[model samples]
Target: MPLKLYLLPILTLFIMTFSSCSKKDSGSAVKPTEEGLKVSLTNVTEASYTAAAGSTYTFQAAVTSKLPSSGVNITVKAVTDPGGVNIPQNAVAPSTSGAIAITLIGLEPLRTVLVTVVITSTSNPDNTITKTFWITNKAE
Candidate 1:
């Protein structure tokens, strides 16, 4: 057999490979839009709160049905005065439920612990919702 026969088969396979990858219907489905999931939190409805100095307060959010049952995430990002209070970084919502809790320990009087709740659809991280809340340490 001529060497050209082997080269011919190899060239055909290479072309097929490239063509398969470029096809519009190469087993690829249209991706769903990142419209995001509907979500709501029953807790922390107030925009601002106050806590006595040297006290610990926990803000619990009640979220159910308003969000997806799976692939959901929640995070508490402290924007200011984190050093004056103890707080958490991030948490994942339970697959069966959407309940989030944020605990703040007040340290300095008159100082504010400002934070934002960053909720993201784990399936579509690009889709997100953020809410800002703050806690001011009350003076004696």
Candidate 2:
């Protein structure tokens, strides 16, 4: 009985030490959530990577939430290309819940054009996300 009693105390001490060492660290900074809006271009038909002058290319713009909460109150307001490529200014989205159809005219030649799409959350108007796509306009 005396031997068993001594072993019990030793076993209890070992278990306590092991558990204390296994405790998770709480000193790390809380990482911010990466949830946000996402944008994609689709339905770009009958066009090559090189933009041809006077050629019209169409694309369907889609917006969704990486987090479900964002999908509810999102607004895609405009699409612009500052690289001298032609795009409709203040282009309206056909459907707030669906994709927006975007059109561009291959006007000036740009080695690379950055097509920027801007979207905002109505719930959080200050929160905005910009997505850019690259295209090229070829000079004849």
Best by TM-score: 1
Tens-digit lDDT track for model 1 on 1-140?
Answer: 68887998999999999988874756876656654545554444456665545555567655543565345677766544646445544454444356666665533566677767677776667767777767665765
Report the lDDT tens digits of candidate 2 across residue range 1-140: 89997998999999999988986888997645545667666753222233434344456667655533443343322222443535444445423464667665543454455555566654455556665565555654
lDDT (0 to 1) per candidate: 0.61, 0.53
Q: Count the backbone clashes (under 3 Å) in each candidate.
A: 0, 0
Each prediction's RMSD over C-alphas, in Å, is 6.5, 9.7
Model 1 lDDT, residue 20, Cα? 86
Query: Relative to the unseen true structure, what is the C-alpha lDDT of residue 37 in candidate 2, on a scale of 0 to 100?
Result: 62
**C-alpha RMSD in Å of predicted model 1 compared with the true structure:** 6.5
Sliding window of 10 residues with minimal summed lDDT for model 1: 87-96
Model 2: weakest 10-residue lDDT segment is 71-80
After the best TM-score superposition of candidate 2, give how far the Cα of residue 94 lies from its true spot, in angstroms. 7.3
